[model samples]
Target: MRFLPSVQFIEQSRVADEFVAPAAVLANRLLDAKGLGGLPPCSVSYFIEELHRPGAAIGLHSKGRANVRLNLAWLAKLAQQETAPEWEVAFVILHEYAHFVLELLEAREVSPGATRRRIEAGHADFLRRMSHLGWLADPVSRKLLSNHNAIAEEWYCDAFAYWVAGTLPEPHAEFFYELLAGVRFPPTS
Candidate 1:
């Protein structure tokens, strides 16, 4: 049940080659641990390139296309560092992979729309409860939590990453736990 996507390095680099295989292995192991070994092999492609995003690094999962793009420069840089950001890199890859998995799970549903509505409602309720606890009083926090679908998707991805790694890197670790404490994603049937 090991799933290895077609990995392509847009730019020729020893660093990219060195990391892709191990990253894929980590991803597969995580998936297997999560009982997702039942998923049929998919034609997902992993493209390593400079994402051109204005952040330290980023990864993207093209919706419905099964294409995951990881920041090549970032991977290379992380590898060259004294303290390799193994957890960070894993998080990026797993988060994007979660998006692909979530889409696949939704596609398997008899009623995808109903599934989405349930997710949105559940997430909205969570936000409301958190707000009542004065946890989301900050304007920035409120604005970010305003979009149920977006926040839910991000939270699900984060949860998947946490589930895979069994932990999350700092700054995110505490928030992620609090955000997903009682949420059941895709809402179990």
Candidate 2:
């Protein structure tokens, strides 16, 4: 598959080329299907292990560097599974791409401060409701909601993934629903 000019796949993992190649192709297809085939140049690197974080993270986006890091170990495992692992992997890629897009939007001031503020407010309100419902009691949820901006950014990213993919993978549906309850995408213009 021909990848978008904006995205380059960087292989820095011990996983077999057979596994990495398919994942990269799937990622490209996912982005292209979502109409995100014209983004600015950025690298998507596959790493040998999960990123150092509080929870089980399969992917991460580095805003300062404008790049994405995926866990090759995780992808390899998924590739071996008989079920539809591609869907989950697609979600992860799109989630990170959402972060990249968010950073670009903010850096270019595409919608100025209004978009960020709306996302923050929407996510803050979602958190408040979740807190009242005791959903924040879970350690993973707590860690994910460490701060206002962090949670807001996460909400937007997850929402973008869902929006682009049409559905969250079954395993992540509940968690994503909780994070994105009432958070609508801000107007692009």
Candidate 3:
């Protein structure tokens, strides 16, 4: 389903309109790409909040609920960076949307919740794939990979976002392409 702004989001538009509107536009593009590839229909609700952390955005979806929270402070900080590219904000938004897509696919499964083994296996597969790209050895990437529970989803989102952003490296990009292409949601009428 197309991303739908939450009622609260619309009510608070005056406070976040400048950023939220643009992010929504980019989100639509990312969602369209996923839809064309067969991801499930799921509505996204977003809000600007004091995430109070460095993360610019976070996406959550499960059992039919999906939402994205954007950290205004972090986003402003990133925008101030001299090296920040024009597409940085859009990429951040798209990354979060990727999380929603993956979670929706998991939720739509016949048996619903994935087993711990399944999740761990997915994490292991991610590590192996990153290792091939020579990213696993990087200290920062290594630390993130070490916490499979906390950071595994980020890895998936990053792969999907980077792939769509046209920045994911070689075979890794192909990995996300096939991974997403495998989602088999019933066609929405």
Candidate 1 lDDT by residue in tens digits, 63-166: 44444556665555555556646566666667777666666656666775654565566556646655675753443344335453267777666556765565
- The runs of at least 3 residues in candidate 2 whose Cα sits more than 4 Å from the true structure, single-residue gaps closed, are 1-16, 50-66, 110-113, 124-150, 168-189
All candidates' lDDT scores? Answer: 0.53, 0.54, 0.55
Q: What is the lDDT of residue 22 in candidate 1?
A: 67
| lDDT per residue as tens, model 2, 97-179 | 76767665566554578557866876676567557758535443343355533667777676566655545333334544433
Give the root-mean-square deviation of each candidate in angstroms: 8.7, 9.2, 7.3
Per-residue lDDT for 34-99 in model 3, tens only? Answer: 443354333434445544465556667666555666665555454445563336666666777777
- State candidate 3's TM-score: 0.59
Model 3 alpha-carbon miss at residue 178, Å: 2.7
Question: Which candidate model has the greater TM-score, 1 or 2?
Answer: 1
Model 1 TM-score relative to the real fold: 0.59
What lDDT does model 1 reach?
A: 0.53
* Local error of candidate 2 at residue 137 (angstroms): 20
